[model samples]
Target: MTTQDWWRGAVIYQVYPRSYADTNGDGVGDLPGIIAKLDHIASLGVDAIWISPFFKSPMDDFGYDISDYRDVDPLFGSLADFDILLARAHELGLKVMIDQVLSHTSAQHDWFLQSRESRTNDKSDWYVWADANQDGTPPNNWLSIFGGGAWQWEPRRQQYYLHNFLASQPDLNFHNPDVQQAVLDNVEFWLAKGVDGLRLDAINFCFHDAQLRDNPAKPVEARQGRGFSEDNPYAFQYHYYNNTQPENLPFLERLRALMDRYPGTAALGEISSEDSLATMAEYTQEGRLHMGYSFELLTNDYSAGYIRSTVETLEARVSEGWPCWSVSNHDVVRVATRWAQGEPSDAQCKMLTAMVCSLRGSVCLYQGEELGLPEAEIPFEQLQDPYGIAFWPNFKGRDGCRTPMPWQSEGEHAGFSDASPWLPIPESHRARAVSQQDRAADSVLNSFRQFMNWRKTQPTLMGGSIQFLDAPEPVLLFVREQGDERLLCGFNLGDKPVSLNIEQLGSAHTVLSDHGLREAQREGNVLAFPPYGIFFARLA
Candidate 1:
């Protein structure tokens, strides 16, 4: 692929810095640690690596609340270490994408600190701040994703500061042209450092309703989890005033314009809004964001119909825009545990990976997903995630999926750290450690390698339009066709076997399968699939 087209149909691996690997024995993963594992990432056949935020932060939201946009956090490493990581990653033929959290910054951030210190300052207008109501209440009824009201009382300024997420992560006032320019400056800084792309965090929340109007209440029956708790009261509102403002589109265009200056640089906007899919379509359309992704597939709902509808809806809505699909990430439960009842077999893991890659547009594979790793059961005492701690049991937060990557089963902390890991590596995960799977031919890791390598050869699977076949439930069948090369892909989502007519697929030659499928024969257009099976056939 050409440099500008590298992200098209590319597979990007997301590395959560804290849990990936630790090089300084600081019990946390760093840039050098990622550099050391570049070969392993390259072997997975991914085009790029999307490293989660490593920018200077107070760790209130891990690294999401950036205090310094242009520098790396001391906990992760210095600027020199980051440069070395960039050099090593490029040497391995892997593009590096950094997370850019433009929606907000740490309260300690110079801009936020200055804005909160007084009512009149040069940077005062950079953050979202408004005067309280006549009755000493917040300006509006906006609620934070972390819980409680989105408005934080500032005694010094005698005003309320808007924070759509955590209060410490005060929202940046993107309506201000200066704020947009400063954000673009940060983008240029990273691009000049030889970074390939950026994964924008909460891209839609950059602007909000200028009127400070109260968000209407969303009845309990009309509510769904917005990555926060139903009990948190944040979910009670429709979130109209705080996010997905029309003003965001122009800012996205400006951001895209800045990125376009650097050839081959791409931007993947994270659309976390009330209607995330619609916002995703809007952001990626035209000259706004190069591409965008939402939490539609990231949710716990796992069904053939839902997945088909999501892809089909986006294809219908955005003609020129692109998408990036991810089933698992730093947030939410791991796919193996979320979709599968509890423990998904190695076969199921391979099926999931193959299904994700076969979808149109780009793909993101989380770090430990290759091992068919289930969510680690973190005890309340061991939980480090503030979200999980706030809503225990019913809504166990993201810590389950954020545990350390197990490299060795018998070593200290599963070879994640010499000392105690920040979070305990579950015993269940130890069995699926990298050391145990390294030599196993049928291991999930090897399956991922083989399938990804094979996928690169099929242009239909890599870059093609997807059409859902008329198949029964528990079985997802789709056709991927690029020009004259068409391929029929079938995936059995359940243990119970189901069959489909292959007359629509035309002449077929068995090419790929997760279950070692070799008994492929055309019986007058009636194709048969084994239990929990997957088949890829090139249409003649």
Candidate 2:
């Protein structure tokens, strides 16, 4: 595949650094540790690896609050370590994509420190700084995704700075050309390092409404959205003025133009806004992001109708750009746990793995997803994520999914660390360790590998046009057509068997089925699918 098209329908495994592996016994994962595990990742049949943030930071939001973009945090090893990791990844036939958090920077960053010094300084306008209202209140009614007000008073500048996330993560002033150029320059630094792609973090948050207008409130009855939970006040407003501003398009174009200078490089954007799907369509159009993904599939909603509607909506809106689908990532609960309602069975994991991979777009498989690891139970005192700590008991934060990977079932700490891990590794996950699954042919890990490898052989699945068929509840039927190859994919998401007449599907024959996930049995013109079954068939 060409560099430009390698990501299309590619399976990109997401590795959360702090929880992946630790080489120095620091209880934190580092670059060298990732290099050591490159073989394991390559064996999973993934096209590329998207490593989460490991940049220099104060750990306020872990590595998301980047203090230095060009260097790796000592906690994650040095720049040289990254170079070795990238080289090894390439040698293993794996493209490396690093996370780039361009929307905000840690308050301790040198640029923010300089910008906050004085209003007359050269860097004064680097960040979004606004004057307080006459009543000494915040400039607007904006609220942070983390909690409380979005604006924090800066004593040095005697003004309030905007932060859509944590107060320590100040939003950048993308309206300023210089700021945009600086952000691009930082991006160029990574591109020059030989990374194949960039996973742009919160890409839509790159620009904000210049007017600083207060966002209109959403009716309590209509407050349901994708990213934030209903409990978060950030979801109370429509989030019009703070993010997904139209001004973000030109900046993205500018960034895309820079990527054009380097052939074979790609940009994948992560968008979260009021209408994330629309924003994804807009941000990824021609000459902008190469692929865009949102939190639509990551939410708690899991049904045939919701899944079909989300994919069909994106397929309708995103005509020119590509879509990257992910069922779980570092920020959300593991799909097996989130969608399962209770404990997930092997059938659920295998079915979800096949279904997500069968989608028309590229796919992101989180670190331990292959092993069917459920969300770890994290206690309040053990929680490290501030979002979880701030809203304890009610939300329990993201630490459950961010815990260390269980490499071995018998190790002191599942081979994740020599010292105590940053977050406790649950025994449930330990039981699903890689070593344990590697020995079981019918394990979820093996099923994911088998199906992913088999998927590569089916061109219809990779670049075909998807057409969803009308199916009854708990049954999702879709056809993927590419030139002479037409494939029909069907899934029984319900707990009971379902039968479908394949008479209209045209000469259908079984192509593949996830390991032991019951394939539909065809009798004459009818197909009977067992509970949690998945079937892929080729049409004449």
Candidate 3:
């Protein structure tokens, strides 16, 4: 890829600093810890590392509720520590992407403090504040994704402030041009810090309907998924008015224009709205975000038809924009457990990593995914994620996926920390620790390394258009073409063995079998696959 487009089709490893490593032994991972493990990240063959938020905060919603956008959180380390880590990552030929939560600020943030002091304050309109109804209730019926009503009553101003997440996370008023410029200025602070890109958090929630309209209720039967189950009231409405407003588009243009000032820097927005895929298409066009990703694939739907339909829908809508895919992240269950058809095998874990990586755009590989780690079951007593605690049995929350990274099999806390981790590391996860699979040739970790290295050589895989072929259940067939180079990719999505003849490739061109997924058997025109098998071949 060209220097300006280095992020195109790149495999960016996501590092959740809280779970990655701990150097101070304070039971939390920090920047110094990341510096200690740069070689391990480089060995995985990923192009960049998207570090989750580590800015100053009260840990209300972890680092997502940032109190200060300019400085590192003392719990994570000093700003100088982040600088050293950035230099080390660049030295190892890895780009660094930091998280930017542009839509909201911590209630304790100075901007919010000034805005909430009184209606007559200088920064009074900086946050989304509105007058309540005649009955003294919230202005509208917007629900917080975390739970309860989205509006929080601020007695200081005798008005309600909007919080799409925790009450501590107050939504910024993008309608205020000053707010947009301030958000962009904070973003530029990091871009000028020599970071390569940004993982924009809740970028779609930057604006709300200016009219403060009430969102229509979703049908009873359709009240599930999209990060919330039916048990959580957040799934009860269409959420049309609270976020994904059209005004956000021009603001994104401003963000993109600022990014353009720092050449080679890219922004990947996390979009979630009523029609997320369509919003993704709209947000990623020219003069806007470089890439957009949604929760379409992050759900429990593992059918080939669903995956094919999701990607194809976005493909149809996207023209000049790019898409980024992720099956697992810090917010949900790990792919190893979420998409398991039967007993989750190491093969399926490796296949899922490659499957997402093989898609038309860039990939975000969550930390510990290379080790094939499953979600840890955290008890209510040990739950740290408020979302899980609020919903209880219906939704176990994100702590299952946010547990500490298991670096060693034989250690107090899987070598993640000397003190007790914020979230407990599962005993099963310890068995799949990095030390256990670092050298095992057939291990999922090694297979991931092998595939990523080989993928770098396939220019077609890096920049090609994907067309999903009509294949039977348990099998997904797709052809990626870039100029004259065509690579046929197929995978067995189930536990049973499958054998089928694909007459599409009449000449049966060279089978690109050197990608280390060496088990897909091809006999003449028939392809046979074991459980969770993968196949990649170059067309004649």
Best by lDDT: 3
Q: Could you tell me how far off, in angstroms, the CA of residue 7 lies in candidate 1 after the best superposition?
A: 0.2
TM-score of each: 0.97, 0.98, 0.98
lDDT per residue, candidate 1, 70-101, as tens digits?
A: 99999988999999999999999999999999
Which pairs clash in model 2? none
Residue-level lDDT tens digits of model 2 in 489-509: 999887789998867656777
lDDT against the true structure, per candidate, is: 0.85, 0.90, 0.90
In lDDT terms, how accurate is model 3?
0.90
| TM-score quality measure for candidate 1 | 0.97
Candidate ranking under lDDT, highest first, comes to 3, 2, 1
For model 3, residues 187-242, the per-residue Cα lDDT tens digits are 99999999999999999999999999999999989875776655888888998999
Off by over 4 Å in 1: 513-524
What TM-score number comes out for model 2? 0.98
Q: Which whole-number lDDT from 0 to 100 does residue 217 have in model 2? A: 90
Model 3 pairs whose backbones collide: none
